[model samples]
Target: MSTHPHAPQSHVHDTLVVGGGPGGLTAAIYLRRFTRDVALVDKGNSRLRLIPVSHNYPGFPEGVPGTTLLGNLTAQLERYGGTVTHGEILGLRIEDGVFVADCLPEGAPDDARREIRAHTVLLATGVADAGLPIEMWREAIAFGSVRLCPVCDGFDVMDKHIAVATSEVNPVGHALFMRTFSAEVTLFERMSPTALTDDDRRRLAAAGVRLVDSPLLSVTLDASMKPVLHTEDGQEHGADVFYPMLGENARSGLAAKLGAETAQCEEIVVDVHGATSVPGLYAIGDVTVGLNQIAVATGQAARAATHIHNRLPPALRTASTRPPSPGTTM
Candidate 1:
């Protein structure tokens, strides 16, 4: 929330991190600690902000709210003299061996655009879930009735009646995965049964997951604030928790515009160090092809920051921290 002014046009940072999520903030911290000039731009739409509470992230035994975690990361970055500009990057391109980002400041006039220059750019823009059919989906998530990642919150819904609803014809994987946490698990297909082969049906039956061919008409909260699914056949089913397995859309447009290779799903393709196919460009977190978890994103940020630091020229050192010559006395 630090309202620092944006860097002047002539000020080209050593690295420019796009997005203000955990991954981007962590990288800014690392790069600043290395004494490298860093700039970060965020549109303020990270998916982490929607998570009510996370029990999977390590070191927090009591669990932490997503907003609290994000706030802490932002504070830590500011403490290290790093600032995040509130803007949407309209386009990214390389010019004269440097990255130029065309950005639209948040709430600015449509024609008022500015360009940010940097030697290297890190795209930490995360993905967005398709979400549920409920109008108050975010409120449902806060109420712990509508879950997103089963891998992240499955333990919390243990022994509860779980419902997995997907538009895909065969979404047995998520239903089966939820079955591991609860004995009463059901899979509701929102599409007409066409691609659901007999083998798929057999697997669900073997796993004790009830398969519902009727599409979910709507989902409403019951008296207890639990999700109650109304199917096409006028049958209503209530569950302790509901998961919409529609899919996710990765925010890799900026990287794609820079000629960076991306997966079929539009996730940025990255190397072991999180470097993209384009030189001086890198991507990490849900934007990249990997597990979309906060822990994984933070770890990827560390790798990319270290690699960028080593690849760039050594930062200027002050006399106090300068190394002594072999024959020189301290």
Candidate 2:
């Protein structure tokens, strides 16, 4: 938090990272190498927040949990003397030549509302919850039953009967990934399914996956339908676990409103340097077009940080050790 005339505007930040998750945090570290005036603002709930232990994060031989990894990242960024603020950026608008981020102290426990005017802004706020229709989905999530990101939660379902509900829209993708665990695997297509090619049938058969093309009757914990998926077709199938890879929204409305071209798939559009179509605004991590793993997010952050730094004008650049000014509270 910095101060100035309006809200006690602080020293001009070389880069303002609008998400403290993987991409934003990584960007802060890289930005600090060139200029210490970078700030990372996040609402505090990362996409990986629900993740338990992540084996694919790289570097951790035993694999670290998502929260622990975030803690380590925060510690590393703070060590670089970068400003990491917990706040929710409610609105993003470009004022004059600077990007002005309007956020309340949502992520911070302290009651402080402020804005950051930076030479450049990175939109790492990421995506949102794509709508999903499921019985007991929310309750199970709150009770630590149903989970997101199979890579993060599949291990817990090992040796359990797993039900993968892929709407007619997306089929055949998760079969390979979810098969890492769950000995009894069932794939359910709610609508009429497209014909699976020989390769599709072969790979699935190799993995001991049963294919079911039927409309879902219901998913209940205590129903006689219990673990079994009682389809309208008068068939009984059991499932100790269920995974839905239906849809997800990449918190990209801000970038889209800014007029950046978006891909039709599940992510945002960005150049090799992680710069979005909008100049001075970049994106990275799960929200960006790359591997959604932590290592990839960390790498993307590092790359975007350097890219933004090199693009900065000489006047905006500061000494590597320069400390951020204290926040001017509102």
Candidate 3:
């Protein structure tokens, strides 16, 4: 582990990526390839870590397991001389044109914290599912029986039994959207004051969607590992897949702490190149209010890195033969 005592010269990085998800890793790889010193700090709790298999992640016709994909990304980053650290960032601040970050190691002592200083910072903390009310939830996702992003995997459930689960005040739209992929669709309005207006009910009826107001009793897998949604009333709904439309909590505190502007859904607002309102501060991936997809994240990372590289002085610019800085720890 690299320990920084807030030394005047040590522990300084050209770029500090605050998440180990696809976005952060991609940025680290690009920045390192640009011959810039970069460090990635992550605690392994990204939303991507929960995906059992992503069939739409491109280049994988059969699909890729989340862990396997992360492993490959890490290997590639290390090969490019990017440092990976396992820690949770607690706070961020700007001082004298430098960004300072405090990170807490996963299992270290409470008092054992490290501070990292960076010329630039990339916020890729992503978002977390707001709430999921299901037993064996992780297993359900692993079996592809429960999904979160409809745009990413909606085609997989085409013409199959599907359910839309939402705890929002109104789930009519989500339920209707799911109906586009399957005729046998059910809306599970669980514990939400969610009600359908007469017009909403008529639309659902027209779309052949069944709306149920009962709260979910449980979600379990049978012998064949198929998902089964049980309701409080003794009604059982078996579906090939279910969508959780609960919501997402964007992990943009690091950006907000630096006084960056936020758009709808509290997502960190960034320019097309992923630069935040605060210069040298950038955000990408689900932390921004966009089409939260892996491909989009990687693209944002590449653009951000290129922009950052252009801002460097000609002498400081990285070169193919330039070795990494020695004082900074990975």
Instruction: State the C-alpha lDDT per candidate.
Output: 0.87, 0.70, 0.81
For candidate 1, which ten residues in a row score worst on lDDT?
1-10
Quick one: RMSD of model 3?
Answer: 5.1
Candidate 1 ranges beyond 4 A from true positions: 1-5, 167-170, 321-330
What TM-score would each prediction reach against the true structure? Answer: 0.93, 0.77, 0.88
Q: CA lDDT of 123 in candidate 1? A: 92
lDDT tens per residue, model 3, 1-330: 222223444567777888999989998888887777776899788778888888899999999988888899999988876767888889999888889888787898879888888888999989877775676888878778888888888888899888887545456777787777888998886764556568977988899988887777677777776777888888888877778786877888888878999976679989999999999999999999788999999899999988887886442534455556989754
Best by TM-score: 1
Q: Kindly list the per-residue Cα lDDT of model 2 for residues 265-304, writing each as its tens digit.
A: 4467999888888888888887876556667777888888
The TM-score obtained by model 1 is 0.93
Candidates 1 and 3 compared: the better one by TM-score is: 1
List candidate 2 stretches off by more than 4 Å: 1-7, 107-113, 133-147, 150-160, 167-169, 176-183, 192-208, 222-236, 314-330
Highest lDDT: which candidate? Answer: 1
Q: Candidate 1: which pairs clash?
A: none
Q: What digit string (tens of lDDT, one per residue) describes model 1 on residues 66-173?
A: 999989999998887888889898988888898888888999997999888889999999987675578588898898998889999999999999999854534678
Angstrom error of the Cα, residue 126, model 1: value is: 0.5
